[model samples]
Target: MLTRLAISGYRSLRDVRIVLGPLNVVTGANGSGKSSLYRALKLLADIAQGRIIQSLAAEGGLQSTLWAGPESFSRAMKTGRQSVQGTVRKSPVSLKLGFGGTDYGYAIDLGLPLPDSTSKFSSDPAIKSENLWTGEMMGRSNVFATRSGPGVRIRDDSGAWRLAYEHLSTFDSMMTHCSDPHDAVELLRLREQMRDWRFYDHLRTDRDAPARKPQVGTYTPVLAGDGADFGAAVQTIREIGASDEMDEAVADAFPGARIEVTSQGGMFELEMTQHGLLRPLKASELSDGTLRYLLLVAALLSPRPPALMVLNEPETSLHPDLLAPLARLIAQAAKRSQIVVVSHAAALVSALDAEPDSRQIFLEKRLGETVVLDGVPPSWTWPTR
Candidate 1:
């Protein structure tokens, strides 16, 4: 689990450290920097996958994504162009993201390449530094792997820093390149753990969504990000993961309603048998709420759970009435893996808060930056180190 995250020079994050929990919910109003926080986490995940540069480009590059406001606000400051004070000294354009977790901690720093008219990609960002350390926090002594620009270094068993065999590209992550289980256990473990962090954001549940249609049956332990194989996933859960839990979840949500998957030949379809309805409602006939509920069920009850599961604005499209059921599913999922949900729905937040250790992080806009606060038990705090 990621215990702490520090982000600097990233949109609205400024210089911030977020201490996390097993089950964390980030909430705030629009423009409260909630979305920015999510994007920062996603960018960190991209680094482990060797896609940080692509991710940065997707967000319109580093220039627009950086904090738009001044480095610091002063009461004596003026808005006029000439009246405004210009920067005294040049500073490196850097964006850094780091996370501390139980087994390992990692951080990556990105900066713009030197200006050159020769190559079109000269404006692209480059990885300036990265570090992988032991324990749940990062410090100079705990460092296991360190990368400075194109050069890479790792710690040997004798507690000595050794240079890696080959150099890596500026846009590539050493974690994705030099990690080897036999040679670098810590680096390998960190890479694998980071690779297992799953993210489910705004699942396409529209009328055209694949989850809304029948799909071929397969033994799936993990649900796809898009929920395209929802039926197969739920059926696999019933067959291998946990059947009782699936029944209880449906019964808890819609009393006397049971969820089942039907397989004809090789095709699999979802069927929900409710008490009031004589016949089981097919996936096509179910309401948007019903389909969405099933999708959530498949997601949470996944037979194979990842190291971390993230949900962004899961309350979207669903009616308020389903928030309670949705919270139950989320809480149940947390038992197997850590979860972080960025939500603003009162019902969903309230329902999840009833869980034993669900942590709430209420974000508010302050000087165009996001601040996290908690008004409940199991209080949340920022990391001091």
Candidate 2:
């Protein structure tokens, strides 16, 4: 499980570190940087997928995504005696993201590419440094793999640094390119863990949502990010002996309600049989809230859970009564996988705060930067650029 998360110079997260637990609830007011934190986690996942550069580009390039506020707030600025303004250069422009877990830790630093008039993509950021270390905290002695610019070196069995790659691309991540099965075993393990970090944002339940349409049935152990395989995923849980848990989750939320997945011509469809209903409601006939809730149920009850699962604004469109049930479902899921929920719903947050081994992070904006108001920042050290 991840013990800590650290991010700097990214969006409103100018310099933020969060201590994590088995289940974490991130809550903040509007514009308090809740979404920024979610996006930062996705960015970390993108690194392992070898698409961090493209993800950054999709968000309008690194320059646009970097912290927009001044580097530091002077005493005068804090005292409101002077207006906040940019200061002279003290360090290179860098956006860093990292996480430390019980088994391993990884950090990456990104900075503006060196001036190259001949290159059309000169505005793209470059990976300045990447480090993979042991344990839950990073230090010089614990680092096993290090990447500096285009070169990467890994510590051999005798603890001697061996060059793994001499000409890595700056736009690519060592997590993907340097994870050798033999020479960089730690890198390979960490890469796989990162690749399994699943994230689910707001799921659509509109008139034409994919979940409402029947898709070809297959043995789906995990729900898709978009929830297009909703029926298959639910049926998978039933076949995998999690039927009781799934039924309980449904009954807990909709009292006396149960779900069933039907197949026709190799396509699976979802239906809900609720109390006092004339007949079971198909996925297409379910209300937005009902469909969204079922989608959440299918996702959290996944037969094959990931190392980490992140859900953003899950309480959206959910009724007040459903929040408690949703919280219960999330707590149950955390027993098998580390979970992080980003939400502003008070009821859901309150319910989850009562769960054991859960950590609550309340974010607040200070001088246009996101800062955690709950606990001390975790111990972390960034690799040099």
lDDT of 2 by residue, 1-385 (tens): 9999999999999999999999999999999999999999999999999999999999999999999988888999988999999998699999999999999999999999899899998889999999999988888799999999999999988999988899998898989998989889899999999999999999989899999999898999988988899999999999984789999999999999999999999999998999999999999999988888889999998889899999999998998989999999999999999999999999999999999988999999988989999667887888787
Global CA lDDT computed for model 2? 0.93
Model 1 gets an lDDT of 0.81
lDDT of 1 at 26: 85
Whose lDDT is greatest here?
Answer: 2
For each candidate in turn, the TM-score is: 0.92, 0.99
Candidate 2 ranges beyond 4 A from true positions: none
Please give the RMSD of candidate 2 to the true structure: 0.8
Query: How many Å off is the CA of 318 in candidate 1?
Result: 1.7
Residue-wise C-alpha lDDT for candidate 1, range 1-385, written one tens digit per residue = 8888778888887767777888998888888877788888888888778888988899999887876666755555533334334354356677888888887788888888767788798878888888888766766688888888888888899889888845688888888888888778888788878888888887777778888788988799888988889889988988899789888888888889998888888788889999978799887787777777778788888888988989888888887878998998899899999999999898898888889878888888675666666543222222221
Q: lDDT for every model?
A: 0.81, 0.93
Error of 1 at 135 (Å): 1.6
